[model samples]
Structure formats: C-alpha cells, structure tokens
Target chain A: MIIVKIGGNILDNPERLQAFLLDFAQMPGPKVLVHGGGKIASALGQKLGITPKMVEGRRITDAETLDLVTMVYGGLVNKNVVAKLQALGCNAIGLTGADANIIPAQKRPVREIDYGFAGDVAGPESINADALEFMLEAGLTPVFAPLTHDTKGSMLNTNADTIASVLATALAHKYKVQLVYSFEKKGVLQDAADDASVIPYITAGKYKLLKETGVVNAGMVPKLDNAFAALQQGVAQVLICEGEALPSINTRQYSGTTLSLN
Target chain B: MIIVKIGGNILDNPERLQAFLLDFAQMPGPKVLVHGGGKIASALGQKLGITPKMVEGRRITDAETLDLVTMVYGGLVNKNVVAKLQALGCNAIGLTGADANIIPAQKRPVREIDYGFAGDVAGPESINADALEFMLEAGLTPVFAPLTHDTKGSMLNTNADTIASVLATALAHKYKVQLVYSFEKKGVLQDAADDASVIPYITAGKYKLLKETGVVNAGMVPKLDNAFAALQQGVAQVLICEGEALPSINTRQYSGTTLSLN
Candidate 1:
C-alpha cells in the first residue's frame, strides 16, 4: 500500500493536478491521498480582509481566518481536487476530517500566546481502518482534507504532512505501507536556501544532529518532527520529495530525501 | 437574551428570511439564532443519489447521505441563508460547525440502528460568544445552520432543533434567551392529529408526563428532549412553535406552543 501527501504548492497548477491524477488513476494498490491548501487559503484571506498570519508556519486561525480557510479548504480546494480525480476516471472519495469522526480531536488549550481555534489530535482513538479498507476494497481512492478532531469536538486546523505521516504510520503497521511526502521541493535540503543539496537520507542519528544544529528550521521542523513521530509509532518508511516534477515513485536516483529507521 | 431557533422552511422564501430578520432586528435584546435546512437539503440529496432516509422522524445520514448534506449544509443552504441575511443588512456569518470548534460534539457510535453520520453535543465550549456578541453588539444576526462539532475533531450532523436548544442551554444562564423550536406544526398539539389545536402552554412537570405518554412522539421526542434539557440546563423558557407562519416577534400569539420551567 502507498500513501501520498500532496503539497499545497502543487495545487496552483491545473495541469500538474491533472498529471498527478492521470498517474494516480493507474497506480497499483489502495492509495490514500492527503492534501494541503495554505497558498489559496491565504489568497482568499487577503480578499476577505482577514490578513493571514502564521505561528510556527501554521495559520494563526482566528474567527475571520477560520471562515476564510474553511471556505477555501473545505469548499473550493476540496471540490477541485475531487473533480480532478473524478475526471481521471478514478473512484475517489473526498472528505474532510470531520466526516464520520475521521479524526477525533481535543481543543488546544489557550497557551501563553493564545492561538485561537487550534485543534489537538486524539492519541487514544485511531482512524477507522475498516472503512478505509472498504473504500480501497471497492476500488476507491480516499482523498482526505486535513482537519482533525480534538476532545472538545471542535474542528481544528491540521498540517497535511502530519496527517499523512500519522495515517501512514497507522496503515503501514496494519498493512505494511510506504508513505511519501510529495511536495515542490526535490527533497529536504540540508540547508534551506540551497534546494539542490538534498539530504539523500535521514536517520535517527542524522535527524538529531540536524535538529540539534538548528538546521531543521521553521516549517521543515514540524514536517520532520511528524515524520520522526510516524517512524517512532510504526511507519516502515517515509519519503520527503518533490511532488511536481517526479516522474516515477521510488525510482533509484530520481530525487527526494528518504527518511527511514535505517 | 433569547435563543431563537428558526426553521429553514421559510428560508425557501427570501422574503420570509428577510421578514424574520426585520422582525428579529427590531427586537431589543441580546439573542442568538439557529436554523435548519430540511427542504433544501433533502431536495439536493435526492438529486445526488442520496435518498434522505427517515427512520422514525430523524433523517438517516450515511456516508453518501452525509456528503450530499455537507454540500447543501455547508455550501448551498449555508450560503443561501448568509446571502439573504447579508442582504437584509445582518452581519451574518454562515458557518459549518467545523469552523472555530463552534459546537463541540461526540460521534454517536454506529449502532445496529445507525443514525448514520449523526452526532450529539459534547464539550462545554460555547459558541465564540464574544465574536457573536461583537456582531450582535454591532446589530448583526448570527445565523447557524444545524451542523455541530463531533468532539472527534470533525463536524457532525445534528438536528436543527437540538442545535438550537443546545445553544440556548449554553447561553441561557447569561441572558433571557428563549429556546425556540419552529417547525411545520402549528404548535405542540394537545392532540397530535389535531393540527389546528395548539396547546397554549405546558409546565415542566406536565411536559414530562406528556412526553412519557407518547404525546411527544417521533420528531417531537427530540424536540421535547431539547426543550426539557434546555429548561433543566437553565434556559429561561422554551417555545415550540410554527417557524414559517409566525406573525412576528412583536406579537406573542404565534403558532407554536411555549413550554417553561414553571
């Protein structure tokens, strides 16, 4: 089984999405797709007078920002992706985290700096794999939007990469699946400024060194943390790679950094 | 503070929603509004191959059923209400329960008799009362569709009346809010078959008796439950009445019955 995380960047191009869907429609096994939508959401926010702000790379979701994002993420972006997938003749089911309690969450407590409406994931209950299997069994690809559950039963914003990693970890342990974080970047850069010098592989030892050296800055920090968390939990392998240009999956010497237990 | 739960029955008529807004706008008090979309949602569902199933009186919301409902609730119905509300100069914010963790919830475990994608209220987090207050403070009406949060971090389907009642319970202690359940019925009938004969009033004690004897049957059961729950939870009063045919907030002799703690 394979789980692919589609970056928000890729969403900008209709051509690329169609390309991705064409490739995806023919891919083997039950594939679960996850997506992000920061770019478009931000644009909508600009129009709505809700200036988008970020805390640690996540949208600082206030009431106004919340409405804007939901409209973008749940409405415009979700439907667009679903339409593309459907056009490619793939039996794809598009859903937000709230559908069927897909992701139970607890409201994040007001911290020193109050972040309004941020949701925390419930660690105790996991995604109902049976329904997922049922969809897969019926030849349907599940395209998930990132929104999660917190104990307060509120819909909270979730990073798609993190959601992908968690789902990968869950599905990997259950069915031995490979999880790929597909983004615009060819791979996780050893230095953020230099995209060419990609880290060929990430290991626990190497990951720690990078973190300790503060090389894993900003957005990459959370993405990697979630990657490592997935590894720690049960995922077999997770890859962070360029989604837009990749012509093949797991092609040796193709591109993208591979993060694994090894 | 009155928590008026309006039915979307009249929402079909733009003039009706506008009239309600005008009537509500003139009312001089702190109040909150909740509403539903039985007609629009069901019609949309039928077109989408999702039959709106009513086991007893509640709509059965399965996966397909829910997808259709979401499209209607979050997209058409929500925006429809918002548009009309906005035109009426109400600073109306249309929301799906998923946004800002508005209404926290617990996913009803799938039973042998499934409620489908339905959810019940959980968590003590009230509406972003301040945000609503800001709007209400500025003379904007907050119109909520019947979606609720499934504490599992996703939006869940909720009956509109229950949503209205829940909001009333949550906000009633702070204001002189009335939990209003507006429906097709003229009022709570002393005799179920006699639509014309609206029960003038019911004491909390009498409500319990009527409820137990099946006078409060089917849809009435949940509505009564929410009504009773609201009273028990400290809501000032509960009004079960005709949402579509009501004369105005100015006149008290509207079609629906009024129930109170007595």
Candidate 2:
C-alpha cells in the first residue's frame, strides 16, 4: 500500500495539481492521499478580517481559524480532489478523523504556546486501522483532510504530514506501506536554488550531517522527522519527491530522495 | 431503520438543533440523518460578494454558488454535525455523493433557466444501497450533505429532501424504513398562521383536499411529493413533524402528521 501526502505547493497550483492527480489516479494498488491546506484558507481568512496567529512558523489555530481550515481543507480542497479522482476512475472517498471515527485525537494541552484547537495524535492506537483496511480491501481510495476530531464535539487542525506518518505506521502491520511526501520540489536539495541539487538518498548519518551543515533547515526538519518515524515504525520505505514524480516512485524511475534508518 | 431529514430552520438554530440531535441521539435503531444547507452558505456567499440567483424560490446554482455551498454544506455543517454526534456516543460519518461514490448523479439539463451546477437524481439506481447498508450494519450513522457528484468530476447542488427520500427507498429492501421530515413546524398545519392547527393524519385523499383548499401551499409541495414518493417506492411510513419530536415518532407517541396512501 502507498500513502502519499501532497503539500500545499502542489495544491495551490492548478496545473501541477491536475498533473499530479492524474498520475495518482492511474497508479496501481491500494493507496491513500493526505492533503494540506493551501493559501486559499489564509486568503479567505484575510477577507474575513481574521488575522492568523503564528508561532515559530506554526499556525496557532484559534476557533475562527479552525472553522476556516475545516471549510477550505475538508470541504473545498478535499472534495475537489475526490471528484477529480472519481472522474479519473479512482473510487475515492474523502474523510476527516471524525468520520467513521477513523483517527480520533485529543486536543493539544496548553504548553508554552497554546495552540488553540490543535490536536495531537495519541498514538497508532488512536487510528481505526481496521476500518481503513476494510475500505482499502473494498477498493476505496481515501483522500484525507488535515483535520481531526476529539471524539467529543470539536474539530481540530492537525498537520497533514503527521496524519500521513501515523496512518502509514498504523497500517504497516497489515500492508507493506510506502510513505511518500510530495511537494513542488524534486527532492531535498543541497542547494535551495538549484533544482538539480536533489539528494537522491539519505541515511541517518547523512541526514545528521546535512542538518548540522544547515543544508536541511526550517520546514524540512519536522517533515523528515515524520518520514524517519514512519520508517522506524514498520513502514517499508519513505520517499520525498515532486508531486509529478509520485507514480514513478514505485517503479524505481522517480528522481526523489529515499530515506532509510541505516 | 429510520431516516430523518432535518430542514434549514432547525439547523440554523443551535439550541433547537442541539435539542433535536439529543432526541435523535437517544433514539434506538439503525438510522441516518440528511441535512439541508441553512442560511450560512448564503451569508457566506454574500460576504464573498457572490449574489445568489433564485427562480421561483429555488436556488439556481452557478459555479460560484456551487463552490460556496460545497464548502459550507459539505464541509462546515457536515463536520460539525458528525463531531457532535461523536460526542453524543453515536458513531457518525459525514458524506457527499462523491464519497465512496455512494450517490452518483447527473448534472441537471438546461431548461428554461440553466441550473448550472444543480443535479437531478436519475433514480434509486443512483444510490449505492449496499455501501449505506454496510455502514449502517457496521454501526455507523451517516450524515449526508446536500450535495451529489457527477461521476465525471463535478459536484452538484442536490436537494436534501430528495436525498433522504431516495436513500430510504433504496435501503427499504434491506430494512423496515421510516422516513421523517423534520422542520420548524410541529406538523403539516391546516392554518399556516396557527401553530396549534397541525393536522394529525393525512391520507392521499386528505392531502389532495388539503392541496385543493390551499392549506398546503407552495414550499411544502416538493417535501410532500418526496414523502409520498418514498411511500410509493416501498418505504414503510412517512412523517412530517417538529425536529424535536423525531425520537417520539417510532414509539407511536409523537405529535406529528402521519401520511398514508389510505
């Protein structure tokens, strides 16, 4: 099974999204797609005169921002992806954590910075892996939004990368899962400005050296952490690639970075 | 099985919706809830500077209106309802027609006025009864949004009443189905101005007389049409009642107008 997480860069670009989804629809075997919110929500929030609160490049989801993200991520982007996949002959279903109690989480506790309405996955046990396996076995491809519910009455903004990693790890026992993170870039780059500087493969040692040298910085840290976590938690392989290169990954023809524990 | 359709008036009122949902939550049996879009979509559309086009009190959905409704109805309202149901201990899943390809529809053809993104149900065949039955058997209550999708990648604005009716009729083969339409009114009233004028029972003949006497006026015509159609299509019973009286209907203790072919 393949679990693909598409970032906002691809989602915000229509041509890129269309090309990527077309590839995704044509891919064989059971698969799931997790997507993040694009600029649409923040733009809409601005229109509503809601200023977003950010701490250390992470969004602090207030009540109003939660509603906005739910509307845009769960509603607009998720449905559109499902509809397009359906048109391309993929039987797709859109889901949030609350749906069918698929991935229930607890609201984040107030720490140094209170991230209001944000959620943290309790663990792999928090996921309804059996339900997901049922859907997959039944030939249903799930497209997930970056939202989860507390099993109480609240929807929370969650990180899509975290969702993908957790789902991959949870489902690994049942299927040989390949977790892929697809974005605009070809792969992790040694030089940010050079598209051809894509590092083809990285082991734990290489990753550490790259991080120490500051070649891998900022947003890439948490993403790589999630990838490595999935690998350690029984996921077969993890790939970081451009959205268009996703279908080629399984065939060993993709130009992307592959991560391994050793 | 009981299939309840909640109208916009009750949904727009949080206190009323909570009361109705509480009763619905406590009800016994396998059930489904279908909800219509409230004023939220229209209000949001206005905020986005998109004017709605309505002909003869029916929304004429264009592309922009379709997006707005999809976000508000399929996203915000559906998730909120599912989250609340989860809190109340009812395992609920939210769905659009595109989800799991559960309800596939065709775009409404252009007639006198083009209903751009509006959809018409082809019939019971458009419903995936087996999927619904599977979910219900698995102890999941489905909450449907007022949207359906063309298998060819377009989400259409569908009527919630029609969705409920079609679902009840399709699932009738597997379960003893009761279809309930819950709105602001206690029941179908003989006098529109009098809250106490709810007609207790209406056979086909009584409905005709009510219609001829102008007691049943414009907005209700389609609702009753759907209810009667459900009965004709093998649904066991149909009721029109206040949203709060939903739980009492199955116990033969409700104060709603019951419809029969007699």
Candidate 3:
C-alpha cells in the first residue's frame, strides 16, 4: 500500500493539484491520499474575523480555527478531491477520522500553549487498520482530511503528515507500505537557494549532520522527523518528492530523495 | 433496515437533535440516518453576500449555493451528528453520495426555471445498495448528507427526503425496510395551528381528501408524495413523526402519523 501525503501548497494551486491527482489516479495498486488544509481556511477565517495565531510554525488551533479547518479540509477540499478522483475512474471515498471512528485521538494537553482543539494520535494503535484494510480489500481508495475526532462528540485539527505516517505504520503489518511526502520542491535540497541541489539519499547520520549544519531547518525538520519516524516503525520505505513525480517513484526511478536508516 | 430522514428545523435545534439522536442510537436494528441542511447555509451565504433563491419551497441551487450547502451539510452537520452518535455508542459513519459512489445522480434538466447544480436520482438503480449493505453488515450505521454526485465530476445538491426514500426502497430487497421522516411537527396535522390535531393515520384516499380540504398544503405535499412513492416502491412501512418520537416507532405504540397506501 502507498500512503501519499500532499502538502498544502499543492492543494492551494489548482493546476498542481490536478496534475498530482492525475498521477495518483494512474498509479496501480492500493493507495491512500492524505491532504492538508491550504490558504482557503485561513482566508475564510480572516473573513470570519478569526485571525489565526501561529507559534514556531505550528498553528494554535482555537475552536473557531478548528471549525474553519473542518469546513475547508474535511468538506471542501476532501470532497473536491474525491470527485476529481471519481472523474478519473478511481473509486475514491472522502473521510475525516470521525467518519468511521477510524482514527480516534486525544485533545492535546495544555502545557505551554492551549491548543484548544488540536489532537494527537497516541500511536499506530489509534488507527483502525482492520476497517481501512477492509476498504482497501474491497477496492476503495480513501482520501483523508486532516481532521480527527476525540470519540466524545468533538472534532480536532490534526496534522496531515502525522496522519499519513501513523496510517502507514499501522498498515505496514498487513501491506508493504511505502510512505511518500509530496510537496512543491523536487526533493530535499542540499542548499537552500539551489533547486538543483537535490539530496539523492539521506541516511539517519547524514540527516543529523544536515540539521547540525543548519541545512535542514524550519518546517522541513518536523516533516523529515515524521518520515523517519514512520520508517522506524516498520514502514517499508519513505520518499520526499514533488507531487507530479509520484508515479515514477515506484518504478525505481530516482525522482526524489529516498530516506534510509543506514 | 430502517431509514430515517430528519428535517432541517429539528436539525437546527440542539435539544431536539440530541433527543432524536439518542432515540436513534438506542433503536435496536440496522438503520441509516439521512439529514437535511438547516438554515445555517443560507445564513452563512448571506454573511458571504450570496442571497439564496427559492422557488415554491425548493431551493434554487446555484453554483455558489451548492458549495455552501456541501460544506454545511456534508461537513459541519454530518460530522457533528456522527460524533454525537459515536458518543452515544452507535458506530455511525457519515457519507455523501460521492463517497463510494453510493448514489449517482444526473443534473436536473432545464425546466421552467433552471435548477443549477440540482440533481435527480434516476431511481433505485442509482443507489449502490450492495455498498450500503456491506456497511450495514459490518455493524455501521450510515449518516447521509443531502449531497450526491453526477458521476462525472460535479457534486449536486439533492433532497434528503428523496435520498431516504430511495435508499429505503433500494435496500428493501435485502432487509425489512422501514422509512421514517422526523420533523418539528408531530405528524401531518388536521389543523395547522393546533399541535394536538395530528392525524394518527392517513391512507391514499384520505390524503387526497385532506389535500382537497387544504389540511395538507404547501411544503408537505412533496413530503407526503415522497412517502407514498416509497410505499409504492416496496418499502415495508413509512412513518411521518416528530424527531423525538423516533425510538417508539418500532413498537406497537403509535407516536406519530403513519402513512398507508390503502
């Protein structure tokens, strides 16, 4: 099974999203798509006079922001992607974690920041792999929104990358899961300014050195951490690639940077 | 299998919706809940500077209105209900017609007034009874939003009553299907002003007489038409009741008006 996590930037761009979804639709075998919220939610939030608060690149998900993200991610973006996939002859079903209680989460504990409606998945056990496998076995592709439920009449804003990683790790026991993070860039770059300075392969040691040298900083750190965490948890492989390059990755083509434990 | 369609007014009321959901959760059997969009969409649309157009009680779903309803019905209301049902210990999954391609519809043809983005289900054939039965067999209660897809790419605004009637009629072959419509009123009342004037039972002939005498007029004509249509299409039973009276429906106790084809 292939678990693809598309970045918010791609979703914000219609042309890029269409291209990525086309590649995704043409890919053979069972696959799942997890998408993040884009500017739409923030824009709508602004319209509603709910200015978003961000601390160290992480969103402070207040109750209003949670509702906005739920409407945008779970409703607008998720349904649109499913509809497009259906048009492309892929049997895609849109889902929030609440849909089937597929991924029950707990509200984030208030230590420093009071993330009002943010959630954290306990572990792979939080995922309902059996139900997901049933859908896959029955030839259905699930398109997931970045939202989960507390299983207690509340919805929470969850990270799409975390959702994808946990799902891949959970399904790894049943299927040879390949986790892919698709973003705007071709791959993780060795130099911040040079797009062509794509790192072909990154081992754990090299990743540590890159971070030490300040080569990998900011948002990419958490994303890479998620990727490596998934790899550590029995996921067969992890790839950081551009959205359009997804189809070629399975064919042993060096389309993007591959993560390794070595 | 029992299919319940809850009206918008009841959905708009939290106490009534909670009471209805508790009753629905306690009902002992495989069942489905189909919900209509409340006034939230129109109110939001107004805030967004989009005025809703209605012709003879039917919403004229323009492009903007379709998006608004999709978000309100498919996202906000559906997820809320699912979460509440989960809290009540009912394993409920929310769905739009696009999910699993359960109900494929065609865009409404241009008639006297072009109903933009509105859809009409061809018949029972449009419903994917096998997929629905699969979910039911797996011990999941489906909560349907008032949305369907054109099977090409576009999502359409569909009537919740029609969706419920069609679903019940289609699944009748596999299960003893009972259709219920729960609204603010107790049932079809003989006098619109008196809440106690609810007619306990109405046959086809009596319904015609009641309509001729103007007891049932305006919005209710279509609702009764849908009920009679479902009854004629092999649904075992059809009931028009108050939302809170849902649980007692299966027992010998009559809480609301029952519709009969005789």
Find the candidate with the highest lDDT and give its number: 2
The CA lDDT of each predicted structure is: 0.65, 0.90, 0.88
Chain A TM-score compared with the true chain A, each model in order: 0.89, 0.96, 0.96
For model 1 chain B, the run of ten residues with the poorest summed lDDT: B83-92
What is the TM-score of each predicted model, taking all chains together?
0.54, 0.97, 0.97
Model 2 achieves a DockQ score of 0.84
DockQ of each: 0.03, 0.84, 0.76
lDDT of 1 by residue, A9-40 (tens): 67777777778767776677788888888577
Candidate 2, which CAPRI tier? high
For residues B131-193, write the lDDT of model 3, one tens digit per residue. 899889988899999899998888999999999999998998889888999878888888899
Q: Report the Cα interface RMSD of each model, rounded to 1 decimal.
A: 13.8, 0.8, 1.0
What TM-score does chain B alone reach in each candidate, compared with the true chain B? 0.84, 0.97, 0.95
lDDT (Cα, tens digit) per residue for candidate 2, span B1-262: 9999997888899998888788888888899999999999988888888899988766799898998988999899999999999889888889998998888999988878778899888988779888888888888899999899999988999999999999999998889899999878899998899988999889889888888999999889988978888888889899999887876786768898999888
Clashes of 2: 0
Q: What is the C-alpha RMSD of each candidate to the true structure, in Å?
A: 15.5, 1.4, 1.5
